[model samples]
Target: MSSKREEELLECPICWDSFNIVENVPYILWCGHTLCKTCILSLRWAEVKLPTLPVQLPLFVSCPWCQLLSFRLVWKGNLRFPRKNFFLLWLVESANGNRVRYCPSSSCDHNFVLPSNRSTVSRNGSSSSSEYLHETPRSSPRDRQRTNHSLLGGWRILTLLMNLTAKFPVVIIFMLIVLYVIPASAAILVLYLLITFLFALPSILVLYFSYPILDWLVREIIA
Candidate 1:
């Protein structure tokens, strides 16, 4: 059997859960093999493999079991959705390290880790450099209402501007070209229609889906 397969079959030395996939259990990966997190934790960092943590580390950590450098591990967490109990595959490092990366999928259970460069660049090259960003999550009713209004206002203004900018120019160009190249004009009109349809169809579908959900939320909040 492959070493990875063998590692998967063997029970975690700590939690005694099967490697790789456990029923809502956390496992650490060492040399492409998985072991229980608890087992990995309890072992004196010598018997278990440790993956490279995402953030900067003072030194590199090695797996105790396989004597190889580790990179990824999975573990369960409290945050959950409809059916699946999610797990995090995080990098392991010393006491002072960076947080693990959250999953990128709209609905994801696994939080994976990524690598970091030795030296990072900043505009000022100052240690005091900071980044400020705002992200909205599942929000309150009032917040949602305000955001919806803002988005709608922006969309309306943008559409109006787009129509004004495009309609006259398109019409004049079409008319001008049509005076000479009848077949070319026909082809251009058809292409324009297809392009508009391609873009507008997806938007219509989005509105169709979003409207019902937004309606329900609004009603529930209002009630």
Candidate 2:
């Protein structure tokens, strides 16, 4: 990609500002639109510490922009955007010598630089991200694949179910009217919808509405 296009990509669609990895890092929503981390964090006021997932990746934070409803993981005990655009992170870090600032007043056109962070540096001075959630470093292909699977395994089936059932309240009632109440002669239509809904609805609802509730139960049994 050209530098201009990359700069455009690094710009957050929500705030229309250049991304600062520290605050305005790009967070991809479930809908796949990337927004500034600051924007996503400001949308939710509820603060809770989620338990770490064993053999699990990040926890799901509700996508405020998705409006339709989707989840992603909460990286911090406080409000930290979990899904990161590391490529963007590298781009910003390599910005040579730029400072991060917050525009305190809405009227302020100039940025007021925030106090420099006391970034954790080892005794030997290697920067470590043990505190805040940061992107993983490069790894072997097998390790990468495993990590990828861990991240997507929980979401893939869940996403499919959500998409399938999203129009259900209208579709289900329509199906009931046609499948049972309509003329019995419409056998073909009834057979198809019946079989499809019957086999799919149970799993769909379980994944969409009830998966979180059951997650603990399954974990307990596994333990």
Model 1 pairs in collision: 14-39, 46-64, 47-65, 48-64, 49-63, 51-70, 51-71
lDDT of 1 by residue, 1-223 (tens): 2324323434455455653333424443423334554544444322332585444322223555545544332237431211111122211221012112222345332332333433446687744434433332343556545544654455456446544643565678888777768977788899999999999999999988998999999999999
- The lDDT values for all models are 0.45, 0.57
* lDDT (10s digit) by residue, model 2, range 94-176: 43222222212442323333334546789998985533332323335565355345434534554465456555666888998
Q: Show where candidate 1 strays beyond 4 Å.
A: 1-10, 14-30, 43-60, 71-223
Per-prediction TM-score: 0.20, 0.32
Error of 1 at 165 (Å): 53
